[model samples]
Target: MCAFIKVSIATFAVCNRISKVLGFDDYKFIATPVVLLMLSFSIFVTQNTMESHFSISNIWQYYSFPFEAIIPFVVFIVAEIRRKRTKVL
Candidate 1:
């Protein structure tokens, strides 16, 4: 769990920087919510532990069906937008 948090933080930082440089501000924007949601879910599942913290009950009880999927879908959309925009440059 600690490792995952660390990695997420590191990756966010790197992505934040890279996105800014690439002028894909939308990447960072879209990433924030997705990353936050995933981290929150992960933390909940980890139950404040390193492993097996999240249970089926918790996932069903607390989070909704679309919670996990939203981030990636938004990311893909943003990526496609960025791709399209880049093609014109």
Candidate 2:
């Protein structure tokens, strides 16, 4: 569990850097789908693991992936929204 959490954090950090490098800040809506896909993958795998008697907190533990994905997604959203509002001004 600790390893998984660490890996997830690392993954999110890399995603943050990648989003900045790829200029995803200009595309807020695009990140939504990618985040959803990543979240779905994590949920699916967690569910499969649960069937094998592995302990995964259905509510909180399963939510970790979305929380992880949200960090970068939120950054992009904030940047995009700021850019748009500035343009309108």
TM-scores for all predictions = 0.33, 0.30
Q: Who wins the lDDT comparison? A: 1
Q: After superposition, which runs of candidate 1 have C-alpha atoms over 4 Å from their true positions?
A: 1-55, 58-67
CA lDDT, every prediction? 0.72, 0.71
RMSD (Å) of each candidate, 1 decimal: 10.4, 13.6
Model 1 alpha-carbon miss at residue 48, Å: 13
lDDT of 2 by residue, 34-57 (tens): 667777877876676655354544
lDDT (Cα, tens digit) per residue for candidate 1, span 1-89:
99889987876776777688878845556577666877797677566543454555565556555666877789899999999999999
For model 2, the superposed segments whose C-alpha errors exceed 4 Å read: 1-15, 24-27, 52-89
Q: Judged by TM-score, which candidate is best? A: 1
* Residue 5, candidate 1: C-alpha displacement in angstroms: 18
